[model samples]
Target: MAYSLVAEIWSELAFGMLVFALRFFTRWKYSGFRGMSYDDLFAVFAVTFWILETVSLYTCSAYGNNINLSVESALAVPDSEVPRLILGSKLAYCAWIFYILGIWTLKGVLLCLYNRLTMGLQQQRFVWVMMVVSVLTFLASLLWHILSCYPTYRAWQIKPYPGESCTQRKWNYVIICVLDVVTDIGMMAIPIPMLLRASLTVRRKVSLVLLFGSGIFVMICAVLRAYYSLVLIDDNTVALGWAAREFLVAAIVVNAPSIKPIFSDFKKRLTENYASGSWKSGTGSNAMSSGLPPYNGKNDIENNTAITSGNHKRTQAYKMSSIGRSQPKSESQDHINTATDADNDSTNSNIGKDGIIVTTEFKVSRR
Candidate 1:
């Protein structure tokens, strides 16, 4: 059971890290190093603490005391094993701290995204409210674990049998679980009204809502973890496994919107490759006789068109003009890439009132 649990934990962590890498690469590719934002930093902090939590989790599962042990069983534990138990207990405590930090840091990442997405809009108000709620909830959970366990050391104490409050940590789990779900709901709520009002098709709006609402799965994980922790109060390994699962779900959900670009790019490349292959197959004999490169439609367009903004004086109006995009209410990779292209073409093109021709990216850095 332990080996299988460990395998599940590590496999989930590897997948989470892959999505995280794509998120980071997407930001770096479009925005560059200078474009690194608070969300990026928060993502770094989140992954750091999650990795630490996993290390502590492995140690606890390997050596920690079983919460199911009765007072008699605890007392009967040999002195030789007491040291290992104590180390496990301490690490378990640290694991909880790491888990708290890692998950809450992910909240910070989402809030940063909301802050940027809602800039100059009425939805900014909700973002502020949710940010305050997030900070309060984070502090509440952190303090509960720190102070709820009387004398601190009692949390890990085995001899004399520390009470279930210190050992099982049911109440602490409840508090964190409730707050975790609440904050997730609040974050999901922020972008929804805006998306509904967005000038997009029903299908597009629904897709965007579903994307942000992916946090619902994370909330479900938190609830299940809490439910089982209270019911299976004796199983330390069960609780730890749930912790890892919740973290994995939260990491993927929060990073989903950020990594959409990767899927989009992959789809585009696949289409191009298929089209190129079809073109090559059709012109097999003629192309071989000419000994020239295959006729690619995409290359033909790129080579034929030179996007030049004739010597028309650049106007500040283009810079000042309000810009909007048909996308989820967040700073997406597509928008970022389009904006980067606009920046590169700043010297070459003069965008007039019809700003639709050129996309301008507005980044709100405030957290």
Candidate 2:
């Protein structure tokens, strides 16, 4: 059982680190470390605490081998084994502290994202309010962890069989679970109004909503973690496993918006390669023989009257406007819309007549 728990912890650590690395790489590719936003800094801190938590969990489960040890059961352990159990209990406490730190730091990241997305909009005020609430709740959660068991040393008491509050810390789980869910819901709320008001097709709007609304999965994980933590009070391994899963989900949710650049890069390369292949196959010559423009890079841009690239692209059919701004213009209007792409790079617009379509990106400037 201990070996299995160790394997699970290692797996979580590997995947969590991978997600963080990809997130940072994409961000750095577009904006160097100096260009990183508050959310990116928050992610750094979150990942740091997560690494600490992972180390603590691994040590407690693998070296201590102290799963399913109730307070009463712990009192009967051999003298030599007692020290191991005590150490495990202390490590478990440290792991929860690290977990709390990582979780709240992620909340800060989400709030930073919301603040940036809602800049120059009425929703900005709501974000400020949520920020205040999040700070207070985080303090409350941290204080609960520090003061819940009382005289903290009892948390590691094995001989006297300290109360369940000290051994299991049930109230801490409940408090953190409730507060975490509330903050996640608040984060999800920030993007909805902007998405609804934007002049986007239903399909695009739904996709954006689903992307931002991924927090629902994290909330579900929180609830299950709390449920099993209380239900299986003797098995710290189960609770730790659930907490790791919850953190993994939250990390993905926090980074999903920023990782769009890598995908956009892949799509651009694929389109360029496909067009290049067509020209090399003499398809261009055949099209010219039939008095039709061949499918080549130059013709592709000329036909659409738009330049597409990994960093920036211009589209005639769709125009993504800034938040807190007017809807996209009609085909008759000569208005130009400059969209901030996944790489945070802007492009010059070209004149074209097409139906209105809108998308969104996070920009720091207010207009």
Give candidate 1 regions above 4 Å deviation.
Answer: 1-3, 273-322, 326-367
With candidate 2 superimposed using the best TM-score fit, by how many Å does residue 346's alpha carbon deviate from the native?
24
* Tens digits of lDDT, candidate 2, 37-83: 78888999999999999988877776563345565676678888877
Model 2: which residue pairs collide? none
- Tens digit per residue, CA lDDT, model 1, 1-367: 3357788778888988988998998776645676678999999999999899998988888886636556898889988888898888888899999999999999999888878777667778888999899999999999999999889998788887887777888898789999888899888898776777665567976987898889899999999999987888777767888999999989998888787765766776687666633221111000011112222322111112111133432322211112333322124322211233344366225444332233222333311
Best by lDDT: 1
Worst 10 residues of 1 by lDDT: 282-291
- Highest TM-score: which candidate? 1
- Runs off by more than 4 Å, candidate 2: 1-3, 63-72, 276-367
Give Cα distance to truth, residue 313, candidate 2, Å. Answer: 24
